[model samples]
Target: MTSSPAVTAPAERVRPLELFFDLVFVFTITQVAGVLTAAPTVDGLGRTVALLAIIWWMYGGYAWLTNALDLARPGPRLLLLTGMAAYFVMSLAVPRFFDEGPFGLILGLAYLAVVLVHTAGFIGTSGHRGISRLGPLNIVSALIVVAAGIVPPQARTWVLLGAVALEALSPVIAGIGGFAIGAGHFVERHGLALIILLGESIIAVGTVASELGDVLRVVVGSVLALVVSAGVWWVYFEREERDSERLLDAMPPQRRGRAALLSFGYAYLAMITGVTMAAVGMKKAVTYFTTPLHDFELWLLPLGLALYLAGLAAFHRALAPVWEWTRLVAAVAVLLCVPAGLLAGGWLMLLVAGLVLAGVVVVSRTPGLNET
Candidate 1:
């Protein structure tokens, strides 16, 4: 690794190589959606969230790493590619993660490699000391993940959740004082990741809809799905992105570290979970557009969107002192559609969510409400 200090220019934009790295995240998101569709139950949801929490923690680490070090250089560039390869291998293991197979062991080894690459990259930056302390915790977490695979299938879920909790708390225990965040690059990196996920949402919808036998139904369902996805895109990009970056840039280093962790790291995890749920919901909506949804399917569409809106509210609250009442209220309003969806169908639920999100976009853009 390069011996350069961890500092990076605050004005730096995301690099092409960073975008390439995000393609792996795209695959990971797809894998997550697949997991949800296969199980579609409370247990499946728990596994999805736990698996994503662990994966996203390390993904955020790479984003922070790129923010601190320029990957245009040969050494950092190569290591990042190595990390990408390991991440891809890890993603490959995601499909059967909770199953009784070698994938659990494979995922553990790949995750360890990813952690090591991330730590090695950080050593070249100003955050080396802090990363040195945080790195072993991540390794131990990876080992815990491996152990989850070894234990009885009935016990794997708890083991994975334990790993998730450890990694989530590790940065707090290790301290973030030494790490430097390039505000612009950090914001842009995550923004791009969100964009990738949003696109995946659409992909999930279109892919599923197209597989259905009816062309007209496919076209209609695809259009409705687009409306919902576009509304989410508008809410996030319209002002949240700018406000987050501006607030982050304006903070002192110490506060910025904590703010980034809470706002981007933790809050975005919720948002991503919401997105994955909504995507699965939309896909199911397409599958059952004419018929009423049963069981967990009925809750997926509305509740998923509700979670996204609520997460956005939390994210705004984390960055600013004020509550985002519009989003919070909208989140609740979306949930009200669950009973109606059971009586009608998922398509109606999707339509109601799209309209609610549209209202939020308009209200958010209103004169006085634009204050961040």
Candidate 2:
């Protein structure tokens, strides 16, 4: 009888250097928040989403890369430091990415460098069959960003969007056969990323609250935003995380890669989108406390909450391979409540959304609440 090779899980603890490396990603998130603060229009919104999509893909690549390799080695360690430098430069350039100027080229090239380091570096070392295919595919995708610099602004936007779309689909397209996942590290990394995003949401609410003339609105809105943020923390952290990690740990080695790709990579994209949009809405709500919400503002918070719930549901489905329709119903309730929510000021809107979120957490505790 022939024996199959053993599958090894990487260390469960996330390293200090990994946390330090994520500091740059936090900076990137703040930069994204600032971009919206700078230009709060439909077009600006598009730009922010495009930039964030690119940044998220780049950041996600690093998580996968580190999970695959022993980064304590001098070669991998140095390579990661080099990538951090690139990320820092990318952050500096993000504010001007849409200006159709030098920053476009700088941002494109910097991202290209990150893509190269993660893909080419790994492929050269591991000879993994999936990565062998993924390497060339991502390099082609990265080159699209470089091409963004050469084109007109409209064309640049389209090019970068194309690149983001391509990279987002790459894992599914590649199938990642025979790839491995460090379930502990993989789960921890994504969980930490979610925490950072929620922190950013809190920062957004506070930033808006600081400038308000009304002490009441500031106090109330700040509290309400925290409630919503807390609700997000509860829903994801309460039981889902532990359960999800267990599922990931139980997955066969060959299959875990696909679940990580779909669950963390694609589904979490929606979760991040929800938080980012909610932050934007919170900022606007604070700015216009006494004023009526624009149709967009009225819809934004509900939309964000819905996306967050729906995304988490998808994430859970990926983890357990079972659809959670009750959660989907909760997502719809968030939207249904929006019209009534808009009748009140921004603070009330947040309060209403927070209630919806709290309800999700409460309802999920009951039997069949998470079932289809």
**Candidate No. with top lDDT:** 1
Relative to the true structure, candidate 2 reaches a TM of 0.92
What is the model-wide C-alpha lDDT for candidate 2? 0.77
The digit string of per-residue lDDT tens for model 1 on 117-180 reads 9988886576777788888998899889888877876787899999999999998788777778
Q: For candidate 2, lDDT tens digit of each residue in 24-115?
A: 88788778767776776666667777787888887877887777666667876888888888888888888887786798899889888888
Cα shift from native, residue 220, model 1 (Å): 1.1
**CA-lDDT, candidates in order:** 0.85, 0.77
Measure candidate 1: CA RMSD.
2.1
Q: What's the lDDT for candidate 1?
A: 0.85
* Per-candidate count of clashing residue pairs (backbone under 3 Å): 2, 0
